[model samples]
Target: MNEVLDDPVSQTMIDIHCHVLPETDDGSVSLEESVEMCRMAAADGIKTIVATPHLFDGVHPPPSRDDIRRKIDLVMEASGGVVEIVPGGETRYSHEIFQEARDKHTRIRLNGSSYMLLEFDFMMVPPNIEMTIFQILQAGLTPVIAHPERNARIQLKPEILVGLIERGAYAQIDAGSLLGSFGKECETSVKQILRAGLAHFLASDGHHQDRRRPLLSKAVSIAAEIGGERYAKALVEDNPLALIQDRGIPFQPEPDLAALRGRAKKKAAKSWYAFWR
Candidate 1:
């Protein structure tokens, strides 16, 4: 039986990232395309999908929360009995936007979830990234890092990611990367991160039908084969569900090498022998 069997069919699936907002960023270009994306998601049994359109500094300007809400209503009306579309924005991370987030703008969070899905640039990472994340925590919102494997900086130096997790930030890998959909570098690094137990979330991040359609299940199978099915469920469902709750989601601290320093000594000292005795 699948580890997913733990949850009933209705609760088995939730997509944390999708771009069903019409003519927004590089995602669905029209209402028709948005409906198609919804249909695709519904066809695959995805009950909930958070529409994560892009927001950045100098790049594509993202729509505001109100705009996202209106569009969500539009999607719901145009769903054609497809999938349920919720509101989330792939928010940009920079010290510049940090003030704006607190003062001017707020985006849609995961449906009834405290976690806000966010992403960084493909090229350079934000300089004061850690401090900004601390600020986010201080403000009482959890930041779910989107597509860490696609970031060139993190791919080059994976430990940079370890530092982020240690600071209480969670990482979400793109489903397409598991299928080598991004490229060789992203695919290789994503697999490595999964083995390292660095990935806590998985998302479709689908942009279109012909190329970037939703593939959460396929990615789940890939993760199951590589990292065990249980880990896959946690990455896709358990961790995400924890984030969705009203209070802050408490997670085990990031995997730390220092804590594993005395591994062999403890392994030999294990109390499993008591059970056998």
Candidate 2:
């Protein structure tokens, strides 16, 4: 497990959507694979990352948070602090799905650290989408919308995101989407999110070793190009730190989406709540 430990930048980036745990879901299938991914993330200049395994109805059968932490401890022992894996999970948005996740032990929270990461179905918009978001917020946790840009229905109606933002929902685009790594539509939509300023957080949503490899460096570059390095750093670094520490994340937006998206085209992570049931 202690294969690679010479991670140089132990003070820079904090990846928001890495799945470095083994076998809980579609992340690294084993502990050794998770270690390798951590090494790769460390090489890519990430200092810290959340191990957001999939917490959905279809995949994992709701693992315990204690179990999740035990695995993280294993990875921590293996990596020797080269990369720290915290307890978090990429949760699917369904009261039913979340009910299943409540049995889980390690559930990843939102960037604000007030809520958890939550993803909806990509094939169609969730029923009562806005109301569901409100319910999540009413539950005393921030509602982070995971990769809304990839959702086909939202893509057709970009203005939906404006409403989401107006109602206090935070939107995060997948790291791969920023790089156009998902597909042309995801690429175009990411551009729109950036231009519209709809995206508040950027995450890797990484699941595998090859194409889905952890690359905060690339996202940093894009953020620099589109929204200055300091701003990018806030989403990947400061904001994330505040989240894990359970601190309030102040919203200081630069480009306003309601005004910005009036002339632009795109769209938008949440988790944790599924496991607390």
Candidate 3:
């Protein structure tokens, strides 16, 4: 079990992306598991957790707003309110998203805010991703890209994510990735993203209480090493809290695209040299 950090910042942590709702998707398997997950989150100092189940992923049918709310209520009650669980979904990129975005009462939006957690395929970024993000923005919702560092395409070319951030989409790095839970490639990409100021939020895209646990202290410490304590706190605390409140992110910084590009070029050159040598 990961011990909660002693820092004051961890006490008010807000996890904007977590899958803890019972039988909602591939998250907590049952109501008991949901309660346990909430306990785990609270122990780790997560005061609030947005229960983001998978949505419009072509696998599970879209859960109705009432169903999500009911599940949230159940978990909150069962856990004795150990942690505040808000309603949200990790919506996959699809044509159906535009329609949901247009709806005033769309359940997919995070905590009924204009922010939405947008997910893409793991293997590739869609070719029409820019246009899709534009449409979502036009619908008055900010798309927070979930775990771009885990994407194969972004791992190979992080500047692609820079373009999306430039296009007004925010990037969220998974806590697990920072701790090398996803592997070295993901860890490298996440560090590069943070160093270049490309990430706006850090969250536990936590699915299980044990495997991908809902803990952020360890990862936040790692982020503090890479980008200072203030910048790291903004990712897990200030920024995400602002997001759930439907306010502008207080810590967004312009990504250093020039620096990122230069690094990419150097890495390519090094790879070429190693190949020849």
Candidate 4:
């Protein structure tokens, strides 16, 4: 006898980070743009997208939870239910963020799970990043470092990311970085992270319909080329779905130290040359 059972929800592609919430941050401009972003994501085979708007309390205040819900509802309706939108925030590292998530006073989580998207400044990793990661873990939430490859500090010191991953945090690679949209450094660092098996998720980090658009499908092939087919599939699907469902992610590969050291040396040499120039 063949008993077949499958949950469609569990077998869908999930984008853990995106900036598609209209008027929330620097993502989509209006409700129309948000709907269009969702449409684009659905067309590109993304079944779920976490609208992770920039959430910096004093710097870039995010929309209220109710407001975010309204926008998501609007976009979901506009997308004709082809895609699912969830409220989340791309929170910059701060000492107070963990408590904020614990209180449930805001949407700091990825779809109300313990998995939170933590972003750093594009230029540098904060001096207290290690302490902050500790704090997040203490609060019983897993911090998913958003786009470490794009940070200049991580690009210069790739080992810093290895340390972060070792400290029990996951790293999410941006699809744009894989496609060399940002620059060579970002692309190289992302490949190194993937090759080393340190990267846990791949997201679009989408902003608008055109430039920073949602193109996660393209990253799947690149991830396979760099990290093998299984790791690439997990990056886009399995791992992200686990976070969404509040379950343990099934895949966590050991980091390749030899590859990390090679990337570190190359990055160091590049930085030293730029300094002399």
Candidate 5:
């Protein structure tokens, strides 16, 4: 069991996605920034944050497992154990990458659990998303699609997200999107996903100390307003905690695929009409 799970104290929030490791990627620039990020999370009532640096994207190679462990230890120590940092990786989409993950040759799984945080390009969904998600499930890991609501493709065609969910992949909504920090399009997508019960987790994809900080209180409140209190808490707290502990989400709700497609078609029709106007 994780030390966080072992502790009896209850935490109101758990951010499953955060780039808080110092100098690891484009996240916190230094050790002080990483510690400051933890302070910010703790202040926002976030007792746990997964230190997910980017992996296998041809951008920046992730740190070694040993280095990540060392940084987690350093950050935890610096935070005086107020907040726990779990090990994870935000991996880009690719058949080979998902294959490696399924083979258990990669430690990039979230907190060493069977849940993998998978990301697609902002402007497009991968052509092999369905097959890749099937492969992930076959490999004994669940694919948690990171911040689908922020993806331009998903924002335009939410049916893409409905398809992924129907194929057994989960979706994580960015806290910034719910808080309208990303933009109007992302915020609209957040509301749509919430309405369809497709958003399974909420995370602070916190990259820096101030601008993209680990602030989730407002997002949580907004989620509650949109989906009711139980659903809201499940997104930011219950589901993420279960992922960290390698347990199934206690409040998994079935995605409303029919409603999602209907909304997407209606939106598309409106756009087509406007194009001719």
Candidate 6:
């Protein structure tokens, strides 16, 4: 059993998605920055952090599994074990993902668990996304969609994510989104997702120690107001711990799909009425 499981109070928060690996991508730029980010996370009550650098984003070359593992060790050593750092990647959606799934790529999985942190384009959902998710599931891995609330397409039609959740995919909301760092549209969408119980994890997509620093307490407070304390805590603590352990999310509640659909229709009707006015 994970040590955290033995002492729930000690491991009160676990961040499953973060870009804390120095120089791996666009996250922490140097070893000093990575160590600072770890300290920030530990100070914010995050006991465990999955260092998810970007992968297959057409920007940085994908870090090898050994590279990721080695970087994690470096960060952990530099940080003096302030927080437990684990290997993972914020994998961009691509045809290559299918092959990765088939091979059960450990580097892309969170802490080499069955859970993969999947990222889509910010402006659009990928073509045949449901089928893609199905393929990932069929390969015996769960795709945890990262920051769906910030996606332009999902913002316009929140119910689109409901369908993905129903298809066995989980959603992770960025801590910054909850704190309104992404703007009003993202904040509103994240609240709707939380209230409807569509969000399965709350992660700090922290890229730097100062700007998008690793923190979850502020967001968890806002989430508690939107979905109550139990659900809010589950997003950052129980759910994430379960994910890294390759276990089913213990706090998952049936998403209120009907509510999301209804709200979308109402918004559409209002937009149409305003168009004529």
For each of the candidates, the C-alpha root-mean-square deviation to the true structure, in angstroms, is 9.4, 8.3, 3.0, 4.8, 3.7, 3.6
For 1-277, candidate 6 gives per-residue lDDT tens digits of 1232323234479999999998999999999999888877877788999989899999999999999989999999877787898888899998778778776656788887899999999999987999999989998889999999999999888878988998999999999999989999899889889888999999999999889989899999999999899999999989999988988899987787776777688879989999999
Return the clash pairs for model 6, or none.
none
Judged by whole-model lDDT over C-alpha atoms, candidate 4 comes out at 0.83
The digit string of per-residue lDDT tens for model 3 on 1-277 reads 1233233234589999999988888888999888888777777778999989999999988789999999999999888887889999999999889889879889989999999999999999999999988989999999999999999999989989988988989999999999999999899899999999999999998888778988888998999999899999899889999999999989987788776787789889989999999
* Local accuracy of candidate 5 as per-residue lDDT tens digits, 24-82: 89899988988888877777788889988998777887688888899999988876776
**Candidate 6 — which residues are off by over 4 angstroms?**
1-11
TM-score of 4: 0.91
Q: After superposition, how far is residue 247 of candidate 5 from its true place, in Å?
A: 1.4
Output the TM-score of candidate 2: 0.84
Score candidate 6 by lDDT: 0.89
lDDT-best of 3 and 5: 3
Once superposed on the true structure, which residue ranges of model 5 sit more than 4 Å away at CA?
Answer: 1-10, 102-105, 258-262
lDDT of 2: 0.71
Off by over 4 Å in 1: 1-11, 103-105, 247-277
How would you encode candidate 4's per-residue C-alpha lDDT over 1-277 as one tens digit per residue? Answer: 0011122223258999998877877789987888777767776778889888887745667677788788889887766766788878888877568658677545788888888899887888888778888888887788999999999888777889988888889999999999999989789889988998989999999999988897698888999998899999999999999999989888998988898888677767978999999
Write down the TM-score of every candidate. Answer: 0.82, 0.84, 0.94, 0.91, 0.91, 0.93
lDDT of 2 by residue, 1-277 (tens): 2246454555577777777878888678887887788788887777778877777647677556777788889988876777777777777876654353343222545322556877878878776878877766765666678889899867666677778777878777788887877789777777777766677777788777776887677876886688677677777877777767876665446545564445332221012344454
Shift in Å, residue 125, candidate 1: 2.3
Off by over 4 Å in 4: 1-11, 57-59, 268-277
In candidate 1, what are the lDDT values of residues 136-213, reduced to their tens digit? 878666788889999998876677778877887888889999999889988977887887778888889988877889
Q: CA lDDT of 84 in candidate 1?
A: 64
Residue pairs in collision within model 5? none
Scored against the true structure, residue 246 in model 1 reaches a CA lDDT of 45
What are the Cα lDDT values of the candidates?
0.74, 0.71, 0.90, 0.83, 0.85, 0.89
**Cα RMSD (Å) between model 5 and the true structure?**
3.7
Candidates 1 and 4: which is better by TM-score?
A: 4
